[model samples]
Target: MIFMYMSHLECPKCGATYDPHKLTQLCACGSPLLVRYDLDKVKANFKKSDLIGA
Candidate 1:
């Protein structure tokens, strides 16, 4: 089963993509990276109560 549908990591500048499970840092192109998530799965599977210390 996929883990939380954490789809992937992407660089907005160079459009480079990386696996979410591995250790990641600045993109190879020397730009900051961004996180992308599977919002569909999150909306369906997650709830406000799932938040911790809320």
Candidate 2:
């Protein structure tokens, strides 16, 4: 299953957003980028039982 709920990468300091599908290094301010996800979509598509084995 292709579970890709990641929407973008955000810089904690500069609040800059980057495309999550691309290879990104860091923000313009040299801050490490953090992943942002579509949590609502993930919750709708995923279940807690899905992790029972893996």
Candidate 3:
């Protein structure tokens, strides 16, 4: 089993985008940028059984 997570930084206020690999204090418009991830990919790459450690 392998565990990994990929994400991207998105600013809700200014609609700005940033790389998730780097550290950012806030968006250019003075709004907090949060990390977003792909849910469909997560469901495809992993299984519920895997989470149970079976």
Each candidate's TM vs. the true structure? 0.67, 0.74, 0.67
Give the lDDT ranking, best first.
2, 1, 3
Tens digits of per-residue lDDT for model 3, 1-54: 222454678999988889877878599999999878867678766786587877
Q: Give the per-residue Cα lDDT of candidate 2 at 47.
A: 71
lDDT of 2 by residue, 5-26 (tens): 8878999998999998786869
After the best TM-score superposition of candidate 1, give how far the Cα of residue 21 lies from its true spot, in angstroms.
1.0
lDDT of 1 by residue, 1-54 (tens): 446778888999999998888858689999887888888887766665466435
- 40 in model 3: Cα distance from truth in Å? 2.2
Question: Per-residue error at 47 for model 1, in Å?
Answer: 7.5
Instruction: Look at candidate 3 and tell me the lDDT of residue 24.
Output: 81
Model 1 residue 34 CA deviation (Å) reads 0.3
What's the lDDT of the predicted structure labeled candidate 1? Answer: 0.80
